[model samples]
Target: MVGGGFAGLWAVRALKSAPVRITLVDRGNHHLFQPLLYQVATAGLSAPDIAAPLRQILRRQKNVVVRMATVSTIDADAKTLELDCDGGNETLAFDYLLLATGATHAYFGNERWAAHAPGLKTLDDALDLRRKLLLAFERAESETDPDARDAWLSFGIIGGGPTGVELAGTLAEIARHTLQGEFRNIDPSRARVRLIEAGPRVLASFPEDLSEKARKQLERLGVEVSTGTPVKDITADGYRLGETFVPAKTIVWAAGVSASPLGECLGVPLDKAGRVPVEPDLTVPGHPDIFVAGDLATLKQANGKPVPGVAPAAKQMGKHVAKAIRARLKGVGIAPFRYRDFGNLATIGRMAAVVDLGAWKFSGIVAWWFWLLAHLFFLIGFRNRSVVLLNWSVAYWTHQRAARIILGGDDTRC
Candidate 1:
């Protein structure tokens, strides 16, 4: 095991009764619930509500041992991984390898822009954005100049994907409803939340009608939805959507995502996005002992469509890999991995969402309820779910976000 994410956790659980001893190594000590990270960034939820300590999650699994270390290199032929631990390299040899390492934000060759437009991918990223967002309003409250105040209140979100859409929607709600009557100098409802997408439509993977419905829901929340607008430059002032100049205090990059750099250590062919191209059984080509899954592996479906980089798909891959390993151990022929697409769900705002369930498609309050239940059900721990539900209920009724306190940052200027 090389990661502690969704794929890694699922794989470990599926092999609980197996005879093999599991050694899960990761740089972090917690398993994060990634889908709800947007809530943390938008002040709808706190960090602890979506993350759990890894040791506590697997304390009962006697066959598993979790190690905290960063993987530095992999000698594929030697079947050994060099981990940088305690300021030195520690090598571990393994008969079987499962690289479940996930993805990171992609800047598309403009990595420097990350200093200005931070992308929400981790706990720290969420906190950074939360501070930036809240501080923007604070700065706007103090600014007397109309133009400067407008710039401070404007928020530019790059991308119209699920994450981007969620961020934009929640941001609009926070500005328009959550913080209403809280500020004396500036009206939070005046905050401009813009969702910019280079694609033809928002949520491009969903059906055309559902995508349009999601756009309308966002618009209802006071979000400016702009499609076919690619971001060109980002700076301290704002971002340039292609040729258009938009002055914003905070810019969030929710666009492209590339697979982990650890995929390079596999010494296998990779896709354009730096994802390993694995075999049918989710194993490295010609190397049955090693497997790849999650966002790190790029495998296509029967219809030639690529498997989406979502939590469900990664969980399915992890479960399939476990089954394959068990079959190989039992001297049985392994079957090709087939991913099951349960459905796609994205919440727009309070009581607004769009869901695509194969033959069935729905949008509005019903889909919103489904989305809420699904997220609560899939949360890793009961404590997290309870806290998140309570937080959401409070926000829903009171129209107030409780986690708006900015924690840390050197220069707090928006």
Candidate 2:
């Protein structure tokens, strides 16, 4: 098993009582709840509230061994993996391999833009963004020049996806409500937060009406929503939208993502997004012993639409893979993989969200609460869920984010 994300973790857990021994290898020591990662990027939640150590999680399962290593190369024919760890390089052999590696940000051929506009994917990325965000306000407070101050205060998020929308909304609230009267030099409420999207509408995957409603909700939170405008270039000072260059000190990239490079190590033909096209049973074309899941694997559903790279879909795939493996061991034919459709949910701001459950669709305060409950229910550990709920309760009543401290950055001139 590779990666400690939802797919790999779920697969390992499902095989707990099986006859086979499991070795889960990952670079990170913890399993992160990625859905609420935006809250950590913003100041709403701490790192510990969403992440739990892998070793502690599987302590009771005696059949599994966890290895902290990075997979550098995979020799599929030999069924061996070259791994790099802190101690030294090593090669591990496996009877059956499952690559559940996730994805990272795609700069759309503009790799240089990453330096100026960072995308959130990991705990380090979130912490770096939080530092940058908090320092922007601090720098604005201390600046004397009006133009420079305005530049420091300006924030741009390039994308209208769930992460971009959530960041924009939470940022607007931080400026308009959370940081009210905190700084004497400048009013935090006056900070400019813009959500830039090249597409025709925000949340394009949702219903047109829900997309419009999400746009309105963002606007109500004081976010400057700009659609149908493509960014030409991004620099340290600002970003160019169409013909105009907008000065902003902080920029976030949430436009696109590409799968982990490990897929290429398999020497298989990949889709345009660098994802491995797996068989109906979630196995490699010629190698039935090898399986792929999560963001790394791509498959078309019965409706001809590609299965989404969401948490639920990954969990389902992991569970299915376990079942398939057990059947194969017993010399029984396993059924083809089938994805169950669950509704989509995207929260815009406080008391605002949208949910699409096929026949049933709704938006606003009720959706927001539903979103909250669903996330809480999906969170892995009880301590994490309780702490997150408590933090959320405090923030809800006070309108003040608790984890607002800036740490570990050398430069403060964000």
Candidate 3:
């Protein structure tokens, strides 16, 4: 493992029962719960609540060894992996290499704004966003100038995917209901949340009716949803979408993603998005000893459409790769990896969500309840799930966010 995202974690879990000696290497020590990363940014949850130490999680597993290191390059010809550690460079040889290294937020050709508007993919990013959001409110409350106050209160979100939509909705709820009575001079309720989507509709992957319903739910929460609008530029003050300039102090980018550079390091054939092109068995072409899974690999189905880069898909790929490795080691014929779609769910706000399960489609409070339960159930540990549930229950009843403290950092240093 070269990454510690959902894919890498699942890959390790699936390979636990195998007889292979697994050495999992990642930059971070903990495996983060990415779906609820928005909650961390919106101050509904803390870092430790959604992250488990990698060492702690696999401590008792005899076949697994967790190393906190960054992979610099892979000598595929020599079958050696080069890693950078605290002390010095280290190399390890692998009979079967599995690349679960995942994707990262793409800046859409403008990498400069990454410093100003950070995307939430890791625990550190979430904490930074939380700090920026809460600090904006605190600064806005004390600002006497109307224009500056408005700029401070304005929040801009790019993209209309599930992550972007959920963040926009939760932020709206926080500003309107949670912090309504907290501020003295500033009405946090008046804070602007503008969601920018270049596509024709939000949640384009979901059903058209469900997308419309999500849009309505966002509007009800006071979020300004702008579809078919492309953000041309971003600055310290805000972003420029063609002729219009939206002045927002806090900007969240959830637009696009690109696969890790590990694939390039291996010199494998990659798709347009820089993902490794894998066979139906999830093995790299010409290298049956090496397997690629999760976001790092692009596998096309019989219908010619590429597999979706969702958590469930990544988990399924991880397990399939592990099984294939085991089968190959036993000298048995391996089955081709097949992805099973497990439906999609996206929450707009409190008591508002949309779930599509092929034959069955649900919306409104029931969908929201299901979404909450499903997320809670997927959380790694019992203690984490219990704490998250307790926190959510308190927030639901009291309309207050518990982790709204703002640490210091300007837009330039984000």
- Computed on alpha carbons, the lDDT of every model, listed in order, comes to 0.92, 0.94, 0.88
Q: Which tens-of-lDDT digit does each residue in 240-351 have in candidate 3?
A: 9879988888899999998887899888778878899998998888887787888889988878888999889988888887788778888997778888988999998889
Tens-digit lDDT track of model 1 for 115-224: 99899889999998999899999899999999999999999989899999999999999999888888999999989999999999999999999999999999999999
Name the best candidate (by lDDT): 2
| TM-score for all models, in order of appearance | 0.98, 0.99, 0.97
Which portions of model 2 miss their true places by more than 4 Å? none
- In model 3, the Cα lDDT at residue 365 comes to 97
Which pairs of residues collide in model 3? none
Q: Could you tell me the C-alpha RMSD of candidate 1 in Å?
A: 1.2
Reference-based TM-score, model 3: 0.97
lDDT of 1 at 267: 82
lDDT of 3: 0.88
How far in Å is the alpha carbon of 69 misplaced in model 3? 0.2
Q: In what order do the candidates fall by TM-score, top score first?
A: 2, 1, 3
